[model samples]
Target: MNIASKIFNSHSKEDGDFFLAMTRILGFKPRKLGVYKKAFLHRSVNKRDKKGNPLNYERLEFLGDAMLGTIISKHLYTEVPAGDEGYLTKMRSKIVSRKHLNELGKDLNLIEHVESKIPKAHFGDNIHGNVFEALIGAIYLDRGYTYCEKFIHDRVIVPYVDIEQLEGKVISYKSLVIEWCQKQKYSFEYEVYEDTGNDPVKHFGVKLYINGKVMAKARATSKKKAEEKASKRAFYALQDRISKN
Candidate 1:
């Protein structure tokens, strides 16, 4: 085969593989493969359209996030007729939390499809969720809202969502600890500082103090993560009292 023919054949095989994979994931044939292509396109790839607009999954992630919230909110509203706005919102939040979304993405092995200049091993946990949302956006554009909702219902609601379980799930330990402290009229502080341990990566250490005593200590690559880790440890330590409050 000529060089041009070889290039065409290679592109054809890649497209065929992507189409089959998407079909299996979506449980339906995709009408347009181009939109799905953008779902896995990372900003690091530096692709642009004819109008010089950047083409990446970031915008699709935004759209998919909105879709997930709307669909999940509707489901919560319908299922929990007696639930107040606050209750419904909290349930919805639990269902669509970043941690939950990341789990969904990872379970589907979505990271394998991402096109990026950065190494896959260097990518963060959020990348999984980001591509998952982008795929939802692509579904919406390629098919429509009905298809998008169906995909979410199949992948998220049917397999994972359980109202009773979600009710007890903690989306943010830091928020819970802070709420408990405020309710009990106790002063709480997260003392965070750089603690570059012996590791090559910079780390932050956090001391979570409640009522002037150090409740828990933890460290992570970011101050927010360090604080949350400390808060989680404190929550377990004070679970008896915190649960009562």
Candidate 2:
């Protein structure tokens, strides 16, 4: 398409606002708006292409995840020459951790542009991060690696990443607690059970047992959350012991 045609197409009523929004978020005019739109296309919409294949952001999310990892790995490789493979991998995990990605997505308000049959309020916390990965995948497909790297550097690395702070940041308190327990040779268990108490949603309750004694208890909508919550409480309660050893 000619320049004028491209401009006219982008300004069409159906996608004009979306086009402008993409330009602002991407920091450049997108060559294919469809790819960008696919990033926000939730699977609940049940869209399909001519080939009868499901069309959603899931594929793009996978691609974006790989792309994000590659770019972040390269950055870490260059910046931290002394870090070994394990250290670098852990640092990268900390940077692209789901919690961090969710924060980034929320900051960008990426959910506002989602095309979904489901209500936004019904979406889980990870939805923001999932779409964020989808957006990165779309960027890679539309503009290739260079553009993808630039976007990550601009939005994630330069703005949010701090090497020193990230070094001390705990990605998973549960992991820390488990590692500590294993190293100290203490018997540990997470006893989880259904705990729906007056709440409409069924909850899971977990008790963190160390040395066969209940160290902490917590409840959440999911078993994993409850376990993590209980582990966090256990960590704080036994911080001095854990830290000293």
Candidate 3:
């Protein structure tokens, strides 16, 4: 059977019902249901389109990232007239951060619809944000910018956006720790080393030191994550001093 036939055979009216429910949640009806299906298709499936291009959400996720940033930036610009460029950018970053997007994706239970060869449990937290971005890409391709904007407003802005709360939000503990150290004129270092463990995934360990004293140590699958974990511990350890200075 051809791709069209296979798609039609695999998806029934019940599937459409489920998609319609998703559309209601997204506030937009997708014109090409196949696009949305592709949006949920994971890279592990190893599927390809007619042109021999990989059919997964990664490319769509990139598009959605830009779209989301644009919409959020516009909202921040209009909402805060007195705010400067840096302030608006930072606020937008906090709102559309990967962590926040992942949470939003999980809150919507998007993983239930994911089509992947890999076990769902094995997927990392970023999968949620990836699906969310793919959803935006599908909406943009199906209905265009107006519908896309509406969907973002309904699903993203109206429900979750709070200027005051976002202002206080921290996008990265690592950045915070670095800033605090710089402000206090204290020398700090993150000594990253390979972790020897039996885990399938290679892990990186980080020892965060401040002013020649060991502050915290952490390990994670990635160096950035390990550093962030260490920085978080360091932050709490020096929270009193940080607040004072």
Who wins the TM-score comparison? 2
lDDT of 1 at 140: 92
lDDT of residue 137 for candidate 1: 95
Off by over 4 Å in 3: 1-14, 169-245
Residue lDDT tens for model 3, 1-245: 84344545788865666566566556554567888888899999999988999999998898888998899988998999999999998889889989989977875678988989999999999999889988888888888888889878976887468675477666678898999899989999999999948643456899999999899999865687689779978988899775788
- The estimated TM-scores of all candidates read 0.65, 0.66, 0.63
* Residue 44 error, candidate 2, Å: 0.7
> Which regions in candidate 2 have their CA more than 4 angstroms from the true location?
1-11, 169-245
lDDT of 1 at 28: 88
lDDT of 2 by residue, 1-245 (tens): 85435666757755777776777777777888899989999999999999999999999999999999999999999999999999999999999999999977876778999999999999999998999999999999999999999999988897567686588776667898999899989999999999978653457899999999999999865687688778878988898765788
Error of 2 at 121 (Å): 0.4
The weakest ten consecutive residues by lDDT in model 1 span 2-11
Top candidate on lDDT is: 2
Against the true structure, candidate 3 reaches a TM-score of: 0.63
CA error at residue 97 for candidate 1, angstroms: 0.6
Clashes of each: 0, 0, 0
